[model samples]
Target: MKHTARPSLLLGIALLMCACSQQPDRPPKEAASPVVVAPAPQTPVDEVQRLLARAARSDPATANDLRLDAATELADRGDTVRARELLASIEGARLEGPQWVRHQVLLARIDIEDAAPATALARLDNPAMQTESAGITRATQVDLALVRADALQALNRPVESARERSLIQAWMSDEQQRRANARAILATLSQVDMGELGHEIGSATSDDWRGWLELASIWRDLRPGPNAQRAELQNWQQRNALIPSLEPAYRELAPEILERIKQPRRIALLLPLGGAAGAGAHAVLHGYLAEHYRQLQAGESAPPFAVIDTTSTEGGFPAAYNAAVSDGAELVIGPLLKEDLQAFAGNLELQVPTIALNFDNENPLALPKLYQFGLDAGDEVAQLAREADNRNLHRTLLLADASPRARRQVEDFNKQWRARNGVVLDTLYLGDLNDYRVQLERTLLVAQSRERSDMLARTLGFKFESEPRRRQDLDFAVLLADPVAARSVRPLLSFLYAGDLPLWATSESNAAVAGNRSDQDLEALRFIDMPWFSSAEATLRRSIQAAGYSGAIERLVALGVDASRLQSRVGLLTWLNEAGLGGATGELSLDTQGRIHRRGQWYVFADGTASPEKARPETPDPSSTEGGTAWQPQEQAPQTRDAPPRITP
Candidate 1:
């Protein structure tokens, strides 16, 4: 059969096969039209505002939630007006549980922000709002409590504020939050009057919370000694044995309580006992012993003490300090001269607590257990600036002697004055006490008055009687000079028609001795000094005199008395700067650097005698207003007196 087919037939069959194989395949199905999705709707308002608008169109309750959130943001930005408007829209809206509480809280917050704490307080006190409800979450309750506390604080109700703050612990679970709340409560309590605090604690209902607050209040007033404080704490613990909640706080405070009770058994006094510094040292010793005896007479436990004579030894302060330490001295107080103190503080490996009787102008190394206390004029100058600041006397005219010591005082005053944002109108240095009119006229700008007088005389073509007037720009004048210079300068100020201006001076303006003819000239001059110099307490003066201390040494005697008493209280003073101890020197407080500063009562010379100025009025509570900021004014810086001229042996 293959042989019978012709070539044309075979060729046709091959062509047919090729045509069938060349047929095209079907095309792939077009990708399914991509599913189109509309983009999210964008609104002009923020998310919260848009949500509120949408919810308002449908669910009013949801609308209120959004509005509350939006209002909270507005309030935070201090936009009270708009926040109030948003809050008003939710008025009468049916809300419950957290929503209701949140609404109330926000309303109160608005009141607080607007400085209407009383109004806020009234709203928060509603009994219906205070009751726990199924809708109120623990967090919402906490917010309500915090808002209430804020309102109470704003209203100046510290007791109420503290009580409200204590309630927060019942709702708060976070430890850090609880600690923060506790600090706030304690700070509020701190502002309360001590007597009032005691009264509040005493009147509180018997409860674990009240007991905790009482414990804190008692601890604050307990004796500074660790032993005394611990005893008090233990007594409180026994009384509050059932208060398991306070266990953590007590445990935390235990170590500090123990440390505060520890005290040195013996103290060593190092002073120059020979040469020019000898008399001053003796006066100090006399005062120290006088206080020791006084304390003994009062049946108080006085620590054993020893005196080492640094001037008597050839090795000076270093040998004496080493000898005293080797003799079992637990504390050292001495090296009266500034140079000796600097040398001792610098060279010695301090093993025990020390209170240097003088301060170094140089920035010396700060050693642990080292304290500096002295009769430096810098203290008085700083106090003068504070008094002026307290009196609202922003502009000051400084009149001081030209001596280096006086200049140093002026420099210190300027430093403190500048710190308080005071303006120094002028600083006049009086070279000669005999003639201060020229200096006064120049400093007070009285030359302008003289020029005016000359102009009037020239205008009228005749001389006329006239007194030059001081510049009115100055609010107060600070005079730093000795009694001799002050006596001469005071009358001159009056002669120059400046008697109307308030004049403030340091202790140096008044002669410590009574019945001075110069006292007449010191009339109306306000001054500040230690109680030992200005006090009318006969017993104190007699005790000092009985110690054979008099004249300039009398002040040194008082310093010694204060120094001896301060040894026991150094720990207390160091820990709490506001805890003032009334000593012979004045109200004493220890600065952060262990420098003791004194606050003297202001005194004014009147009717031929110096009398204490009236006590200043109590500062009004700043929280009384809607404004939450406390407005406490800065008080006088504690001052130290200047050293009298060294008496020769």
Candidate 2:
């Protein structure tokens, strides 16, 4: 919540215009001292004038009291400059109790308005204000807390601001004000990263703080759909029954979500069901239907689904999409290819709300109703670049295997890194397994260091021994490789004395085996990948695998699962810009351009196990790579699949 002053000068102008005719040439001195013209002042200008007049005629101590009232009136009117000046004229040490607390609060309010949150917080945190806090009125207490929260928010301390808001929530008497305050708390908590919020929940000592954090975490989780989110909400309520301050906000969620849960009279999956892309299309179809069936099992309402095969139609996506709309599909969830999405970019508007399965890699024209949600490699690169920037890793080294996809990823990272003014000291493409060490040594400056050491020994005319040192200017390295290449290259870098350098990688480098001793070679390497790989989502992965969906293609299945889950809640993502929908592929959030960005879970390989970064370690077997390795899907499923039924034009 925030407060602002209006045009008090205009109020003064109106007062002068009305009173000019009533005044005599020589208005009496007593009149000059001013009487209460009316029982209540007409506006903030009148109130401030009346209080200042009374202060002029009162004793020094009482005059200071009236000045405080005048300052508050000025602040309420958004005349903070005048409010601050009036407040400064009074001796702060002379005030006590409620007046003293109010004095500090008003000063902090002015500081906040001046864009100095630290100064505002410092004034509010003063010991003298706390000493007299007990004597402050309920309204004053709320004001104190509100200002403190605002300062904290301005300083980017979202969790602490949320806590402060929660503290004074009950003190708010107006029902509307209380509800707004609760929303303010939620909005602030939403600004926090989901991963950070999870950690905060674990360490939170206050029941109130933990409840708010948990609620936010629940909202950010990758659930299957609105039904799953609502279920999680119910679970949160069951877990935290005692903290009722946020009940109004929690109660407010059900109706809004329930409305979304009832939306999209029908959903259409437009895919190339009988062509080269048939298998992937069928996987998507299966995953979407899986979520639909799962919701049906839970007795939740879901829109009827219709499938239209783009490949069977002569006109392709345009014809298939028309068919879906002709069948009363309120929301269309496919045309699952980049080329199909290119058709969307050509249109000025889409007939129905469309969630395209693939993103147009070329410069895409913005469409009002087109929402792109797919497993985009660019999203991971952007996230990693941001993570590296956040860690202050300015100077970077890039290493990638010789592959077309790896080349594209490297180019994307360079663009993102350069956009941030980050320096890429060197970039190397590893061509052969035999040349891995040589490539690393040359790019890392290890060979150069060894040459320099040997040259110095020869100049000394005696054998002087010194170990070679790699370049120390680099802050981190980006490795673009698969698990196999990473396994070989990571250990070699360490042996070459560049082991201490932090490595940031993409999901491609993540191995399928968990806690495999062979993974010991990948220890401490950080990578970002789909939530499907995370152990936390093992149940969801198992459910998909149980349905005969496995291997690399499972990623597409996960994409389809998210697409189904996202159909109803797209509005939620749009409404709350910071809100994220949890999905099998990643934590999904929407951008203003109608592009959905995925933030994958971060993992660090530790002693042969790829565990969630900074989270508690899971026990690992000390045996071989095969021992204690959790069963994940192989690169390819065991059997060949049959073609799904074709959709005729």
lDDT of each: 0.65, 0.72
- Best candidate (score: lDDT): 2
Candidate 2 residues 212-238, lDDT tens each? 888777766646456667787778777
On residues 322-376, what C-alpha lDDT tens digit does candidate 1 reach at each position? 8889989888888788778777556677778888887776765466788888886
User: How well does candidate 1 score on lDDT at residue 483?
Assistant: 80
RMSD in angstroms, candidate 2? 14.9
Clashes of each: 6, 5
**Which runs in model 1 stand beyond 4 Å of their true positions?**
1-263, 433-435, 445-469, 534-538, 615-649
What are the per-model C-alpha RMSD values against the true structure? 25.0, 14.9
